[model samples]
Target: MGEIWIIGATGRAGRNISAGLRAGGHRIVLVGRNAQRLAEAAATIEASGGVPPRTLVTDDPLAEIAAGRPDVVVNTVGPFGTTTVPTAQACVVAGSHYVDLANEFQPVRSLLEMDSAARAAGSTLVTGAGFGTLANEALVYELCAGRPSPIRVRVAAMPVVDGLGPAVLASVVDAAATGGLIYRDGRLVRTRLGAHLRRIPLPDGTTRATVAVPTGELEAALRGSGAGDVIATSSEVPTGRMARAALPIVGAILRVEALRRTVIRLIDRWQLTPPATPGEVSWAYASAEWEGGETRQAWLQTGEGYAFTSRVAAMVAARLAEGDARPGAFTPGALFGADLARSAGATITLDSTTKDLR
Candidate 1:
């Protein structure tokens, strides 16, 4: 089997993915800056009856990737706005397949723009290989499978994570710094952060509130459904009226480079207490409206958010390592289709009366 290298192996997502890959009988190398933490993570995997993984201690992971050229590289670092391009470029140069858990707009868009380069290099690059992008993008693909391009599309990501690490919080801050974005008439348009608030009907018949945010799901939905107008909302963001009103101002303030950096540094140091898990079920919802009053909607249901993310990232990396993916840059759903979500333990429901698609 080809060797898989996991960057940020000391982090939660990285550790989980490394363990998962190991359990699948794949060779994995754990890379991180802190030798002790990397060893600790590796030891935990070893304790689980898996072969002890090789540990690479390095602050310059990109340089290592460029020189060593592992068969596949899994990046769990964030905010991916800074990590994604450099790491992915290194992988492309080394002809190594790459996967990441990025869901932010700019990084996802920037990575997709490298599709031609990746294809030319014969390197497969999969971004947004986590709950946020794949879950919703799969629904959009299923909802619009055999139809003409939808006139409008909306996707909502409502993940129920057990807890969050500091890196997750930092990514949230980075995303807020990017302001708001949507697709209007097939063109990317800027709008106020938290601009459109909607109460989404859930499969369980309850309504959950979501607000517009500049997530990668926006781009994924646009491309998946071929919709001229698209908006991506999330239950992760503040949806209350007061919070909604303040989002634009907060977004504007964070857009200042220095302030954004400072806020991220403070967030790292604060070491927030993990919040209570929201609920047992996480959901991704999508609704498409075509010309002449035709509409279709769908939902994807899964377990805890982080567990699903770890499974998705590990599965993508494993497939890439095994030569199951094409040589190009893509979001997970676009590359492997909606079955990728099903393989990662998500069930899709096309409508109220329809049976779940396993």
Candidate 2:
């Protein structure tokens, strides 16, 4: 069995991913900021017939993690706003395959910044093993199938419209407040927030919304897979009547460090939480034009973005343990085709002819 190390084991996604690994018969080591949470997570993994992992909690997290020597590292840590690079480095030193549920582009850039180092270490690094990156990258790959020319693609995600977690909220705020990475016209462009918005139909046929978020995968995929013109959307601050009302003020409020802290506190108190269970469902769509004047549509409508991502991480890890994977810092779409990814468990649907948009 492969030795799996899950960092941030105290969080919701980490617990579920640990269980998923346990069910698959991998030895699990739970890592958390607190000793008690790590111990608790280890107990649950053991109860599920998994060999309980050694817990590592210390002030020096990176050094502690490097010593573990795990076979695979699954990090469910959030606010990966920072800390991604060092974590990946620890895995590299340990000679382990590294993966994370990172949804933001900033951390992804930071984590993969060590491409040459990771290659030298013979470690395969995977990011956004979570929903946004997982779904969008996989969907874009499928959308380009059967196309002979440059393809224009758009991608987005809408969590069930209620609200989101604090980490998620912080990310949204960061995206808006910082106006992250963007690429266009064959050049890397970093623009301010809400530069563009479009009306895209949901699976329910209601036109929701779409905004651009930074994407490294799209750039990598375009270069690696011969796709052209990828218009990727990152996670956006929720917009609607309520958002339109509050965002300008929120933007102004978030400018002041004190006011921003207060806003986050109030949002947490309101507690607008998602489900406690692991299977919170999310939907994603990708579309593009192919040869012979045809449009192809492919989508991943799956349960709990994080849960789905965890499984993807497990599958990638199992392949590594089985010695069947290629090594390098490559996007998921570059590593596996749309067909393979779909068979792996994404509810991937592809259609060459689409009247749906009409």
lDDT leader: 1
Candidate 2 RMSD to the correct structure? 4.1
Off by over 4 Å in 2: 149-151, 161-165, 202-204, 215-228, 234-236, 241-281, 290-294, 339-344, 353-358
Candidate 1 stretches with Cα past 4 Å from truth are 273-277, 352-358
Error of 2 at 278 (Å): 14
lDDT of each: 0.91, 0.63
TM-score of each: 0.97, 0.80
| Candidate 2 residue 50 C-alpha distance from true site, Å | 4.7
Q: 1-358 in candidate 1: lDDT tens per residue?
A: 7999999999989999999999999999999999999989999999999579999999999999989999999999988998999999999999999999999999999999999999999999999999999999999999988889989888999999889787777888889889989999999999989988888888798888899998999999998999899999998998988999999999899999999988888877896534645899999999888776667789999999899999999999999888897989999999999999999999999863222111
Residues 268-350, candidate 2: write the lDDT tens digits.
Answer: 56854443322355677666664445676766777655556667766766656556555566555556655445654667776
Model 2 weakest 10-residue run by lDDT: 272-281
Candidate 1 residue-pair clash tally: 0
The clash count of every prediction, one per candidate, is 0, 2
